[model samples]
Target: MAGSNFGTAAKIAAPLVLGGAAILAGMHRWESQELTVYADQLAGGLPTYCSGRTQPPRPVGERLTQARCDAIDAQTATEYGRAVLACIPADKLDQNSFDAFTLFAINVGKSAACGSRAAQLMRAGNREAACKALARGPDGRPVWSYASGVFVRGLQSRRQYEANWCLTLAEAP
Candidate 1:
């Protein structure tokens, strides 16, 4: 009877362990998909600042390849994801929230994201407030005004998406 009981416990425990692993794997895949979506939204290469000088421009039109653009996107996403994970506790965020925050960090710089009111709210366990805070800019103005003291439709759209993601639970892509 004892041996039979032990066998039943092992059967139950095994499924639980496997289910937990599958959930974790799904989360990882979801995070990767979010990164890819962000990269696609950002599009291909544009000159970035380096020592106050613009970096070399990427080949335009025919000279630019999808593979090359993908490589750049993947590299940039990986860097941003690492920076975000370093400063934020993974357990504190759901997949959608994590993706939104990672994108915000990518756009606004790691230090700014880490120090922002949104991050503070997240740390304080006020996720709903943090989601709302996503709409605010570094200067506490709306993101639309961050472009050039005028409302930018694109910025507003992006902020809306981020805020929505923060507020909703989304499935893995």
Candidate 2:
């Protein structure tokens, strides 16, 4: 009943609705735990950038190997994630939004994702626009070639996920 159902689609959707449903039906209670596991696998646990690491750069549909992405994800959760959550407004966020932002924060350093123009828009209460801003990517600069290895691809996906999560809040009874 909680957590926006890619992340699920991408990571564990099959189980939630199919085979995984039994184990994850009440997973809302364990989202934080799941995040730690997820962060440890994808983002390098806050090491700075995955570009220089031995792992392949993140791309859509890329399958992250446990050996490569695991350590990074944990490092990300420790370094940037905790701080980002600390800064996020408790009243303004839900489990799904929190999950989405945490993942985005991992993709683009906490400072970049949380303080960029995009995040500013979200904080100012314009998530619809903020979601659009997420894909704009560093003044429309090229992510791979820019000084900031901070491209907006992965973060954009997370943003869209967050947007979807937030959008649903409006339809809630």
Taking all chains together, each candidate's TM-score versus the true structure is 0.59, 0.43
Per-residue C-alpha lDDT of model 2 across residues 78-106, encoded as one tens digit per residue: 45446555665544444444454554555
For candidate 1, report its TM-score: 0.59
lDDT of 1 by residue, 93-158 (tens): 665566677666656677888888888777766677777788875466675225435576666666
Candidate 1 stretches greater than 4 Å from native:
1-63, 137-141, 170-173
Task: Report the error of model 2 at residue 154, Å.
Answer: 6.9
Q: Clash number for model 1?
A: 0
- Each candidate's number of clashing pairs is 0, 14
Give the number of the best model, judged by lDDT. 1
- Report the lDDT of model 2 for residue 20: 23
